[model samples]
Target: MSSDTQQGRFEGKIALVTGAGSGMGAAVARQMAAEGARVVVLADVNGEAAAAVAKELSVGRAVPLDVADGAAVDAAVEDVVREHGRLDVLVHAAGVDDPEAKQLIADALVEGRPPEVTDRLGDSAWRRVMRINLDGTFHVLRAAVRVMRPVRAGAIVVIGSSCVFDTPVGYPHYAASKAGVHALSQAVAKEVIASGIRVNVVAPGPTETGMAARTPDVLRGGFADPRVRPYATPEEIADIALFLASDSAANLVGAVLLANGGRFTA
Candidate 1:
């Protein structure tokens, strides 16, 4: 489906993608296969969904996993290693969004808010958001690097949101966590360069995916801007993912590449 596949850069390489059931995760899984990866590990909480995507590609296997569960993540990594012999690539693409819950938290951020109105920053909803996006990311990376380090080679590409910069007023927790991701990725890249592992992040802006389709109607109308007519397709974002996964970006490490479509001026 891509020139990458025809070129066969990933002909014998194996890749593991988290949240491969839907959204950017599914897109990336497909793209990785297209690039000729002999084996791919599709990991997601939704086992059936992951299997379906992996089945569509037909060059990979799926494993139901929750990145939030460290033990589960560890076991899944082991499974991939057992089956593939080594892990060369890891992509973190699963995440969740709840604008309403986030808006409530943002409201509390307003000064003079009643003490009774606790902030969502530390609430259950916020905790879950951070747990999945932040803690889960860390958990997956820890496990991936463990396998990658010994091999003295690997590439980690994480899916981040462009919202981290031009973020809406609501999701402070999500933004903060993603911000932490970029910083941590840079720090980890520096720490692991000597180990022969590379870490980088891709920030996709307003991608056309299941996640965008499910965004509330109120949110959809905001896309009517004439200057920003079309949303970037998941495949376009996957192009960046593939480049990051390949030797094209071999010199890249601790880099945060933004793929947002002029949503915010640099």
Candidate 2:
């Protein structure tokens, strides 16, 4: 958990993690709870999954939410604030990234085959991806800022994609959505900085999550090429997210921290 055994960085704090059912989100929630957060809300679209994760953490509470709905997002935030009294840390991790579909596209490209029109960044796929990744980020960010700005102190860590930098082929929709997220984060960071609220992003490359597990072996090998390196564990991504949310990054605002192994360089 970030290798900072010093603990208490988040003691007495309240953290809300969207997509806390699994992957990097769950890892962040666990790490924060270990660091002494008084409360951690596990917000996810999958209520059962969220409940399962919450059952493992003493301070965890599962809240089912769909970030695409503005009203639902607002209500969810209100519930957290009412129960916890304050939201010191927020990790936005809920977004759509269908590994199976992504892997198919990658495999086709590698084999010099033309992807099916319907499956290759079609209008339907584009809209679905954008609604979840782009629109969802907007909904949650707006809801959080409304509550946090008044308090004059809060931290928001957005989970973006390394696709913004790598810009790989076959997944135009995914890359576009994540790039939009980075832009949104930067703009919001500037708008909220004066209010004592910090907003930053974490752009992670392929990691050992359900999303990446569906990739073909050949494609995975390319990702692990000597220069690019192999996939990272969810824990590694969680560590970076924690660091950005912690006071250690007080001087940083609107920064996109990369946790993509060696996929992108300085």
Candidate 3:
């Protein structure tokens, strides 16, 4: 959507973007369409939202999918290939965070009290996060690999969190889930590179998205620094994802590119 976007970079490529209903996923889908992707399948749990976003693309369609359901994930990827002939790119952006838990921690931080979010975390909450974030990523990535391995040509950019590098307080489950995604991506990247498939991770920090908007101001304030903006835009993050999924990053395999402004240096 910018002048610097490489026109036709994805010409003849078919892309599948999870969490495409909103946030960074939608942004990636939009950019892929702009860059001439043959077809961009917008898959999300929120079917209506995904459909709304798909209406904006020339060759985009909505596919209702809950990535937590491994069987459904496999079916969705198989359907995409069956419909489009080949799967050239995949951007796994579907993930979850406990905003209520984060707010509780932020309250404690503001009140000068020790944050004990994990102690209060229930088994259901923890499992829900892991199911959607870690397990969901595994399912989607595995599905993509199945389709791409035979073709010996494809790119995958999984959306991880900067928390993998610097774990944030009150986000134990979220951080752990993203860490799993990061590790899984590297392991699979090594296994698939020989097959001509490149798998990479984008670890983004505080970005302007629905999730970030839900975060308390007290917590967001911690990210404020004169050196860089407090938050990156979804479109900005999408640019990084799109680059990784394109030939521009052909040599980058198992690389975790951080897009957290200047929050973390490692």
Candidate 4:
């Protein structure tokens, strides 16, 4: 008889995943664990969901976190470092959505161009989008750097979007936020090499998660070319993230690794 224990490639590293309550974050956390990471801290704005994911992963370190809150972000980093003694992997998956901008994106897809913004594009919409998608990733990266730089060893995988390139029919704000993520990864990869900390972006497209189902229909069918299918699963994208987090991608700093099944390439 063969043993069926799932083994990890990460074997003994400590990882922290934000937005681990669901979607790609949860998937990434599970994959990291399976690949041999000894410890995983699941952090989410929704404490119960985070805890559940931690339990599902069978790890005990689930935490409540609001990535938009700088103090909370800092504390979470400190807690992970203090408890784990060192940090080896960081995954930023926490984020928010903008239905208004999404509508614009979808309209552009269905109508072939964005409808005129006759004053309905609220300032609040822009700020909230930046607050979570952009600012949230910033806070996590900044806090992780403080700890990882000290050890002179770490890898950060930011969850970005295909929209940055394909401009997914809706969610312009999401696309813009992801574009900022790509730029930040490139800048930090340069800034952190001296400290032996690497930063990279993994932009996944049309993953088959709850979030995908909620995506604007125009956005979903936008990749309508018969030759290319855009849909992916969280587990599928997680495998890519696992490689990026592992030693295999040691030289892959500042890379915008795409895992979109040839949607844009085609």
Top candidate, metric lDDT:
3
* TM-scores for every predicted model: 0.90, 0.93, 0.98, 0.90
lDDT by residue for model 1 over 156-217, one digit each (tens)? 99888787887566567778778877777788889998999999999887788877776665
What's the lDDT for candidate 3? 0.93
Please report how far candidate 1 places residue 51 from its true position, in Å: 0.7
**Which has the better lDDT: candidate 1, or candidate 2?**
2
Q: lDDT of each structure?
A: 0.81, 0.87, 0.93, 0.81
Candidate 2 per-residue C-alpha lDDT over 71-179 given as tens digits, one digit per residue, 9 for 90 to 100: 9999999998998797889999998875646667676777789654344555777788899899999999999999999989999999998889987766677888999
CA RMSD, predictions in order? 3.7, 1.9, 0.9, 3.2
Model 1, 58: alpha-carbon shift in Å? 2.2
Give one digit per residue, the lDDT tens place, for model 3 in 35-131: 9998999999999999999999989999999999999999999999998898999999998899879889899999999888988999999999999
Reference-based lDDT, residue 104, model 3? 91
> Candidate 4 lDDT (Cα, whole model)?
0.81
Q: Which predicted model would earn the best TM-score?
A: 3
Off by over 4 Å in 1: 1-6, 102-122
The true-versus-predicted C-alpha distance at residue 225 of model 2, in Å, is: 1.4
Error of 4 at 12 (Å): 1.3
Once superposed on the true structure, which residue ranges of model 4 sit more than 4 Å away at CA? 1-6, 104-114, 117-119, 168-171
